[model samples]
Target chain A: MLAFRKVVEKMEGYVPGEQPQEKGFIKLNTNENPYPPPREVLKALQEKVTPERLALYPPPLSDQLRFKLSEVYGVPPDQIIVGNGSDELLNIIFRAFLGYRSRVAYLYPTYTLYRTLATIQEADYLEIPFQGEDFQQLPSRFLAEEADLKVVCNPNSPTGTFIPMEEIEKLLQSSRCPVVLDEAYVDFAEESALPLLPKYPHLIIVRTLSKSFSLAGLRIGFLFAHSEVVKGLLKLKDSYNVNILSQIAGVAALEGLNQVKENISKIKRTREWFSQALKSLGFQVLPSQANFVFVRSRSYESLEKVYQELKSRKILVRFFPEWKEWLRITIGKDQEMQILLENLKEILGKEWNQGA
Target chain B: MLAFRKVVEKMEGYVPGEQPQEKGFIKLNTNENPYPPPREVLKALQEKVTPERLALYPPPLSDQLRFKLSEVYGVPPDQIIVGNGSDELLNIIFRAFLGYRSRVAYLYPTYTLYRTLATIQEADYLEIPFQGEDFQQLPSRFLAEEADLKVVCNPNSPTGTFIPMEEIEKLLQSSRCPVVLDEAYVDFAEESALPLLPKYPHLIIVRTLSKSFSLAGLRIGFLFAHSEVVKGLLKLKDSYNVNILSQIAGVAALEGLNQVKENISKIKRTREWFSQALKSLGFQVLPSQANFVFVRSRSYESLEKVYQELKSRKILVRFFPEWKEWLRITIGKDQEMQILLENLKEILGKEWNQGA
Candidate 1:
């Protein structure tokens, strides 16, 4: 009865990190900010909700928001393009670049969404596995020389490991194809690929308001690339992909950068504290630059058991079956982290010091 | 320095109907509702604009908005899928259904966006010209036998003419392909293909809040299809295609259905009056089932010249280069219509009465 394209029929859609319906859970499965965005975001919505403003079509290219983003990011307005979310921008990039028999390469177990997008495009993909627990890119072996597009998720998801700027530069300089630095979590990292844009024309860096700006629900994402790359993506994107509310809220969020920086600093502080706490609980935690920490305990089965026990106690942290022993825990507020620690201690009993 | 897909590089992007930046003109070009959406839309935004609400990922599937849509449309919640707009839904449909070398069929000079979508998909398309000025579909020739996907725009754009339900049924019955009835303008039309859903599993009807609901800026559109079709689209769509504010505002808009109906009634009433006035003033007005009238004057050049004259006098209506002799005039408020009439009379002078 179904006549969808072969790829679509065979492929499972990208499953997002679960968002539990109940309110009592310490919701950390998704890497959403524990705090709210700047008051200006809310203020913008309140002031801009007039009948006249909501009646007309939004500026098609989001010119005002782009101009504001330009001022904040120090990139020319033409070099940036925004999307409903970075997901939409990724979809556009895939559509504009990948065709029949196109090859894409990214690190395995990075953002799983890349694999799903490649599958949807029917593109051949090379998932280069990271060398070790550090999730390091084996640049010489694959991405720099092969594939039509190379995706590097700086401060990669789940792992929360940040790849260095020099490594990204080497890939951009050596690669025949365009390289995308998905810096969705880079606001918490040491530096950004945005600084490398002027030197590397083929380098595209994507950032999201979902994390640093605390506007995940508002669905605002932007990419910085050469003007030609931006022009090509504009051709593929839905004209009104980003709505009027997102544009207004995004502008306000940018305008209140000081508030966002404070929130980021708080989250970073919380991340460091949470990592130490997890280590104290007999878990080996990776040094994380993003808002989340990746950890593995003494055994795979025990790690799996801890995830279930935490869920039963109304704590939601991410677990990957493929990784088996590892858990990606988003850093919530200090109180939420304390509750998580208490629950984990209760689940372990006195055996926590026995390292399994 | 550019490396883009051939289809993307060679094709010009879809240019949306001109949204004049400086907005003093009686803006009628895009068929936007002259009235506002329900007061509840604004009220919801004001109440829901908390820090916590805008910080998390939106409900990935938009379950709450879909539930409300289901209640209003009498469709099952499982059968509805909300999009950033119906535009995003169309993009998903194209991606899921079409592949390289796939063929698509649509009416000529319908929503111009469809052809652009087909180009982006790199699919071959057949543009079947409508029979005569009434823009009737030619069912027997090509659509059923040849194309993999069939698109029917009901209460079609520019012309504002609708294909009858029975005609649509006949086409759906005969076609082996999936048929999408884009009902973006259907709220003002006589009948909808919605009732045909149970009978034809391959049929999809797309609707938007942009026109009748006066929520153009908010970008909420949904499709009614078989649950399986929705499942396929869900796989192809970005996880959070619809943002949180649009979801909240859409739910509130649905709650205020009475206000939407009243606005629709006013536009329909104005459409009838305005069509008659144009007819009396030497323009051949097509029978409209939408909020706009498709008109033609004595000569193609004269019609073109009239558009320019109207623009010069701070009035705006859509002019299509391909449909050279025609103008799509959106029905505005009585006062705006009066101004349009006065300006047209002034531009044409006594010559307008002489049919030129």
Candidate 2:
């Protein structure tokens, strides 16, 4: 009586962060930009939603937006392929590379979507655990390219720790299979994998406007890779993968680069200050290159209580059961961060003291 | 140096109909709605582009849209899943069902995307060819449950012939695997396979806003199936597959069903008139239930010449090389169709007659 494939039936699938509809919650759970996109993005969106534009099909390949991204990344147009999101690109990569016989490897506690995608494809999943609390170094065997496809999320989520470019290059050099460098958070960090595209034929760098550009609702992402790799991916991509409104908004975000850069800088500065503030409150905060801070309270028991208390106060932050002691909090505006700190101090003082 | 899988490297990808950017041509190649979408759709788009909405993630799984679609289709909320486009839904289906050992079947000269998708998934393809000019029947063996997944495009594209519900039901009842009824153009046709969902748990109906709702540029599409089928698809879908603007525009389109129905009726009328007009000029035409006419001149050589003449007149209609004698002409507005008729008369008289 069962119609679905064995893999789909067995899989629980990826659960995204809860999107609470209850009003007045400080939403810091997902790593979305707290600030609104630039004014120009709205203007571009205004122009694209007209009757004439909505009636026609979008350009299949998103040529104009890809051209704009090319100039921004200083890459050839052939090397760029736009998708509905980097999420779609990840799906396409799996379809093109991994199969029943093939296997995929990703860092343990990385973007969980890769695992979900592999499960959907029914491919073998190899979890490569990072060393210690810093979660930086990978095992030598994991880097030897045992899997058909390998994914590394730079400035990894939940941990907010970035792997250095030198380490990535070393892995790419030794790896026999293609490597995907997911740079979804790289805009907040200093280095990008775009420069390494020409040198490493096997490298595919994925980026998104959901974070740095503050347009998560628009769903735009791009892949920077060698032309040959891009060609294979293009074959697997859905025609008209990117919607017209997203393309317009993406271009507008690119045009207003200075404004977006200012916002990123503000988030980074706030992240640093927020990290120091969390440390002062007797919490262990990981050094983050992304827009979010990953922190753990003084004790493991305190973590669950603090998260619940924060939720009761309508301040939402991400708590993963696997990482029981840790919490991933996105950097919001200064005012939001201030309220968070004040709330944290009150919650920690009352709850931790009572528990002790 | 070759990094892609064997299937990816060996297969020729799907090439969508040409999107001509040159102005003033009677742009009918891709079957896009010639008239603009309803005013309400634009209004919805305008409302959704706000800075605040753009900064956050769209409702994962598009809950609001599915609710609206539920009321319209008289199906429960769980039975519908929205996608970036039906194209994306197609991709998800391949990932969920088809695999290395699985096989897919689709009618020849139908929507070519199905074959391309199966190729991308590395699934074996069984292309069921229609007998003659009117592609009305599928081979009996194709109906037998040989393939893991079967696709039938109702009001079949390129040929524009509609199969009755009885045929669909018979196939569904006999199908050993899941059957996907792609009703991308079903709004223009008289009947759909929607009512069969309750009777056949294996039936999955895919519809798109690209054709009837005239929101192709927005990239909104939906799947109507049994709740169990929808559940399997939900697990495979990207968390935030549909963008905010598309969801808003889709809800608005649903709200403005009257306007969309009026547009569909008008296109149906134009299609009738245009089919007669083509027949008057000694051309062969299949009975079309969709928004376009599938036509071929009396002589095969004359068909290619007429296509070139139409292009010379800056009236672009789709000409599939594989279907060398045939041309798929999207029915535009009355005036546009009239202009197309006059131009066709002139081109057929001059170039096609001269070649004959």
Top DockQ hit: 1
lDDT of each: 0.86, 0.85
Q: Which residue runs does candidate 2 get wrong by more than 4 Å?
A: A352-356, B131-133, B351-356
Total clashing pairs for each candidate: 0, 0
When only the first chain is scored, the TM-scores of the models are 0.96, 0.96
After aligning candidate 2 to the native by TM-score, how far in Å is the CA of B171 from where it should be? 1.6
Candidate 1, Cα interface RMSD = 0.9
- The ten-residue window of minimal lDDT in model 2 chain A covers A347-356
- In model 2, chain B matches the true chain B with a TM-score of 0.96
Give one digit per residue, the lDDT tens place, for model 1 in B1-356.
Answer: 75798889999998888888785989989889999889999988988768888998989888899899988889999999998889998988888898888988988778888988999888998888788767765556744567879898898887899899878989888888899999999999999999999999999999999888888898999999999998988998888888989999899999999998898889898988888888888889989999999998764454777888889888999888878788999998999999998888787674553544
Once model 1 is optimally superposed onto the true structure by TM-score, how far is the C-alpha of residue B136 displaced, in angstroms?
3.4
TM-score of each: 0.97, 0.96
How does model 2 score on DockQ? 0.75
DockQ (model 1, Cα): 0.82
Alpha-carbon runs more than 4 Å astray in model 1: A136-138, A350-356, B350-356
Candidate 1 residue A20 C-alpha distance from true site, Å? 2.0
Per residue, candidate 1 scores C-alpha lDDT tens digits across A1-356 of 65899989989888887877678889988899998899898898888768876778888888889999999889999999988899988888888888888989988778888988888888988988777767755547764557789898889887898778777777877797888888999999889888788988888889899998889998999999999889888988887778888999999999999988999999999988888988898889988899898888764454777888889888999987768778899988999999999988787774543555
